[model samples]
Target: MNFLRRVFEHGRFGFVLLLFVLMVSTLGWKIVDLHVFDHDFLQGQGDARSVRHIPIPAHRGVITDRNGEPLAVSTPVTAIWGNGRELQAVRDQWPVLAEALGQKPGRLSERLEQAANREFIYLARGLTPEHGQQVLDLNIPGVNALEEFRRFYPAGEVAAHVVGFTDIDDKGREGMELAFDQWLAGVPGERQVLKDRRGRVIKDVQVLSNAKPGGELELSIDLRLQYLAHRELRNSLLEFGAKAGSLVMIDVRTGEILAMVNQPVYNPNNRRVLQPGVTRNRAMIDVFEPGSTVKPFTIAAALATGKWRPESVVDTTPGWMRIGRYTIRDVSRGGQLDLTGILMKSSNIGISKIALDIGAEPLYSMMHSAGFGQSTGLGFPGERVGVLPNHRVWKEAEIAALGYGYGLSVTAVQLAHAFATLGNDGKSVPLSLIRRDRAQEGHQVMEAEIAHQVLRMLRAVVEEPGGGGSRAKVPGYHVGGKSGTAKKVSTSGGYTDDAYRSFFAGLAPLNNPRIAAVVVIDEPSKGGYYGGLVAAPVFGRVMAGALRLMNIAPDNLPVETKTAAVVPGKGGRS
Candidate 1:
């Protein structure tokens, strides 16, 4: 009996031992299968949990003025973002993170709830890098800060209309920023990195791609002139109680815009104040009747026809004339005035007779050649090309209106361009907003002799006694320009009775014109609403400063006897 019991115990032990050996052998086989046969698969699964491919942001390009001064620039900034799925695990840290972001806990909670299903989301943007780093130092899982760029305009509102501003993502939204967006946006790069259990980058594994920065844009804006124009226009709007105003100055020799400014300007840096009405660049996009500013071109047309000269006489017997049903009246009696006198007096009757005699085709051809009815090719978005009538047959009233600067519309820039054409001795060059090392090639639009004559005649409007634009005279400079006031078209159709647009268009140093400018005051409610009263002074002051800044010798310096102060040299010469 004892021997049988011992044999059974021995059999039970052998069975248990066999089972243990089988288990050990199977475990060893499985270990070898994973570590050797499926090595790549195992490693990939491990990497999938902690390795990340992240984006490396590239900086945007810079924008400079013609003189190499920084107008718009991109400054390094930071943005806080997160992976919603991973952030959910650290939900308890919501209040702490909210505090760091300067946001309420409830607000942060609501934002998280809205983005619960999103893999990636932005928590805050446009934060300083130091603030962003503090948030990242919290080491909360799934929370990260990315490097970004914010546009900074050094010139601020002074250059807001021309340089424009960008969006939160550094995307160009308006003005020159939008116009040159593609050339100013940068390309992002990709990098592979390894993260720890807390989701913090532990190592940079590899760089998959390199970032490429955007190109620079240099505009022809002279900042000094821009500031001068801005100050004068802003002050004028306040002084005249005008609804809005625009001033445009061009380098006649090069067709380069030296200065362009508008009233009601908003600071591009302040996003909250970016309303559509205030941001509109009225100088380029708004159009109005040229008024008497167009009289110079009309006289140029008459001169081109060989029928009128600077001394040609026009019969203005009663200072009023009837064409069809419309009676054209002068502001004052302009009886028996010459061609120059008609322009100086801004006579509606005398100009009407001249238009009737020379006909509309010649005037249209002349104005069109001077760039009155076409785009300035400035490539600005929403720029309007002013209206100039094109008709097979014209009514006598239309012809008469066209002669005295009516039945037509022009932008302030376009008006400046036309005057610049006259200043360029009838040569029409393409208008440019970008800087050019030299003057652009141009085509002759009118005879140099004719343009010179018209320029000389325009001088009488400012220099001669009893001239309409006497207020436009710049001290110590030979100033020449015309003043105009036209009734604004009402919203319900015909012209408004009370509202009017005042204008002044002219050039300085009349013999060797360097710059031409146009100023427009819209709906001046206070002070005098006449062009001579409101707009001419702005042109005079701005032009005077521009000429002095440019170091152009004054052509109309006061005459005096030989004296120490009178002589330009150290000692008076014989």
Candidate 2:
């Protein structure tokens, strides 16, 4: 009995000792694993559940005019974002959240269910900070206000087509915004942050990447000039009851677009109301037959061949000519007009005779050198190269039609560029929408003497009494320009009777031209559809204001004022 009791006690003690050693071994192993072998791994696993790497959005750049006037800027705003999984748990607050977001509860619920598998989703974008803050104060699970920017156009419709607008994610959609997107879009950053179970950011753990703000874009537009152009174009459209219009003002010396305005403009801030036609930059994109505006180029081509001179005369006594079953007529019988008289009267018969004399090659070369049938290299989006046919394929009738501006097409910018070449003394410079620091090298397209002679003739068109462009004359300034009225081409194929595109292209201060401008009024239904009556007055008004604003010295003396000896008041008359 004693031996059996001793065996039982020893077994009990051994078992107790074994249990203690096993407990000590387990505790020691756990300590070693946590403090040495698997420390980083366990910590990383814990952090994965509570920490997040988030993106820090970089601000887009500001777009300014040449004078440093802000056209487009990024305004600070807040966006409501949410974690779908966490947001789903806050069903009770869904109605209040929906009301804040301007959505119905059912819609919000549906969206959450649809996004249940998504980590992130936008609840609302482009909310004012005050409104976004109110939502954040609700403290609904997973709901947060993220810092963002909304594009704002200070000039509104006056500069909308040039500055453009960004999409919901701050990506450029149109205009200069799209053209220089990469330069205006900055690099985003990353940061590691600690988040709570409810998906709220608790603290920033570390910054992984630094945000680089976008670079500034300075354009060649002059805001004052742009506003003037916009106002005048708008007024002209209203006065003439036109379907659409466009005006482009360029610096003759540099080929920089000082102002570009299009009628039927849309506000960039209101994207919902934007239409495709209203959003198009018509000055650079839309092409039309230039009509009589192209006569100067034809005249230049004739002069370039040394076959025509300012005094050269063409007989238009009958006012019409037949070219292979096609009849070309003049507005009236010009009756043996000179080169200058052809432009002054806009005689179609006279110009066609001149073109036939010069042949197709010379005329085509002049048009091509003036920047037709090619891009202007402005890098604008959707810019069209106006159509000019190959001279080799031209028939005799086609060549004659082209001379009077019917067989080809040219954009408003191309027309302005061609006139600018004339204003620049026969040198054609590349067009620029961005401000250029140095003078650009120019291509000598026509002889300086010939260009000057054409300029003189254009002056007669405006300054001379009862001329085609008489309405374009500006007091105290020698203005030179041409008028054009073209029948609109129909969708079915031929020209429409009542529809017309009126055009006026000109330069100011004829002696030393500073500005070149083109005004085009499409399908005027009220007042008049003629370029001289409709389009010329717009150019004259806009140019007069622009010249005054730029402080250009008057090239012409004021109407000789008769200074009558100041007869003192009637009582003091001597």
Candidate 3:
């Protein structure tokens, strides 16, 4: 009995000791697996649950005028976003959330439902800081505010067409903004971050790449000139009740676009007010028959061929001529006239005789060299290359019509470019929208003497009494320009009777020209339709202001024989 009891006791002690050893081994194995062998795996699983890679947005570049005044700038703003899954749990609080986001509760709920499988959705984009803070103050779950930038235009509608605008995401959509998008957009960066179960960022782990801010862009536009042009064009549109108008000013020496403005302008700050037709940069994109503005070029071709002189007289007694089935007539009889008189009278028959005498090749060559039928290389998006028919296939009527600027079409900038070439002494320089460090070399398009002769004739057209463009004269400055009135081509086929495109292209200070400008009024309804009446006044006003702003000295002082009258209201001497 004693032996049996001892064996049973020993067996019991062994069983308990074995159970204790087994428990210790299992515990040690679990500790080793968790702290050593499977440590990285566990950590990876944990990171996968709570870590995220977040994007860092870079700010867009600033666009400035030639004077370094800001045109388009990026201002700090905030955007609201939500985690749809997290937001679903806060469905009861949706009405308050919707009110804060300026949305209806039903719409918010539907959006959250649609995005339930998605991690994020935009609640509001490009909100003001005050508005964004208002949402954050509510401290609603699943909703967060992200810092972003919204583009602002300081010049507003005055510089709208030139500076352009960006979309909600800060991508360029039009104008210079669209032309140089890549140069103006920066690369985004990324960082590894740790977040809680609710998707709130707990810590930033590491940066993947640094965000680079976009470079600054400086344009050749002068804000002062731009404002002046905008104001004058707007006023003229209102006064004339015209369909539209465009004006462009160029630096003759440098080929820099000093000012470009269009009517029916929309403020870039407010996208809600934008329209398709009003948003276009009309001066660069819209083409119209140049009317009499092409007359100088015709005369230039004649002068270039060594067959014509400034004083050469042509018989335009009846003021009309018939070519094939088409009969070209002047507004009135010009009688017998010299080359200068022909331009002053703007006689169609007089120019037709000259153009026919020169044939098609010389005239086409002259226009081609003057930058017709080509792009200005300003890098503008959708810039039209105006139409200039090939000289090889020209008929007699087409060539004659081209003489008076009807057969071909040109944009306002193209007309300005041609006039600027004349002002630059028949040397053509490439146009630039960006500021240049130095003046560019020009290609000789016509002899200096010929250009000067044409310029002098243009001066007589403005300064001489009874001339077509007499109203174009600036009071204290010598001005030279051409007046053009073209019948607008009908949508179905031939030219319309009542609709017209009025134009004035000119240069100032005949002694040494510095500025070349072009004004075009489309379908003037209230006032006279003639270019001399509708377009010249706009040119005069804009030019006068531009000259003063540029500090150009007045070339025409009171003739020594003329006297100044005294005002009786003040203590000034006459």
Q: Report the number of clashing residue pairs per model.
A: 0, 0, 0
Candidate 3 residue-wise lDDT, 444-562, digit = tens: 98999999999999999999997889778898999999999999999999989999988999999788999999999999998799999999999999999999999999999886775
> Which lDDT value does model 3 have at 3?
100
Candidate 2 per-residue lDDT, tens place, 313-421, comes to 8899798889998899988677989998999889999999888888999999999999988999998999999899985477879999989998789999999999999
Off by over 4 Å in 2: 1-31, 559-574
Compose the digit string of candidate 1's lDDT tens values, residues 435-542: 888898988888999999988889999989888888889988888899999999999998999999999999998979999999999999998899988999999999
Could you tell me every candidate's TM-score relative to the true structure?
0.90, 0.92, 0.91
Cand. 3 TM to true fold? 0.91
Best-performing candidate as measured by TM-score: 2
* Cα-based RMSD of candidate 3: 6.2
What does the lDDT come to for candidate 3? 0.91
lDDT of each: 0.90, 0.91, 0.91
**TM-score ranking, best first:** 2, 3, 1
